[model samples]
Target: MAKKKAVGQRGSWFATVDGIELPCAHRRWAKKNWPHYHDPFKPTENGPSASKILKYVQAIKDEKQVILTNDDEHLDDEGELTGFTRLNYIAIYGVENVSFDPDAGLKFTITKRLVELR
Candidate 1:
């Protein structure tokens, strides 16, 4: 796709996939809405969610299959398996009252969806 860039030595930006991961479209974000596209939400509970869209930018990539996992099993600080599942990341997009959408034609619903640049 976008030349795959130099595969970062690290896969998970947070070092580990223990929580809901919000990637910055890797650095390609600079060309898009940048913070607007990558930072739709501010993380309130942990941070604060975005209130309104300053600007809306169209998507660039074609592949819609997100890096999702049904097994949303997370690990606590002590490395113990937590029962809570962070599979639903729609909140990151400032979406409320959401429900899972498997159809690849819609926006980030309530299910686990990810994107992988090939």
Candidate 2:
């Protein structure tokens, strides 16, 4: 059985399908719900895999520019491009928690603070 989230679990539940990410609800009050995305790697744990995290860490170590983009296809309210736009950023201070649903084959999100080169 899948482990349920903490008390009053209310958050975004996502899954990946053919490289496309799909979203749904999570932690029903009565039932155990989970995404149905088939994990090709068949990971033993629920997350983005070690290789994914290493990529970013390596970039930070090498002081390489990290590309930033919005997941949405529309322009964000903050003026950030919703689509792909080349934003070269250097000096990543640190990275936040990175996790995902293994059963759903979800694409994990990486949160990091970047120092933009002026």
Over 35-109, each residue of candidate 1 has an lDDT whose tens digit, in order, gives 222323322344211221211111212222223222244466987544333332221112222222222212332
| Maximum-TM-score candidate | 2
Show model 1 residue runs off by greater than 4 Å: 1-44, 47-62, 74-118
Q: What is the lDDT of candidate 2?
A: 0.29
Residue pairs in candidate 1 whose N, alpha carbon or C atoms collide under 3 angstroms: 42-48, 43-47, 43-48, 44-47, 44-48, 66-114, 66-115, 67-114, 67-115
Estimated TM-score for each candidate: 0.19, 0.23
Per-residue lDDT over 1-118 for candidate 2, one digit per residue giving the tens place of the 0 to 100 score: 2221211112222222234232321111102222221212334344444666444344433432222221222355986333322222222223222234434332322244333222
As a TM-score, model 2 comes out at 0.23
**Root-mean-square deviation (CA) per prediction:** 13.6, 17.6
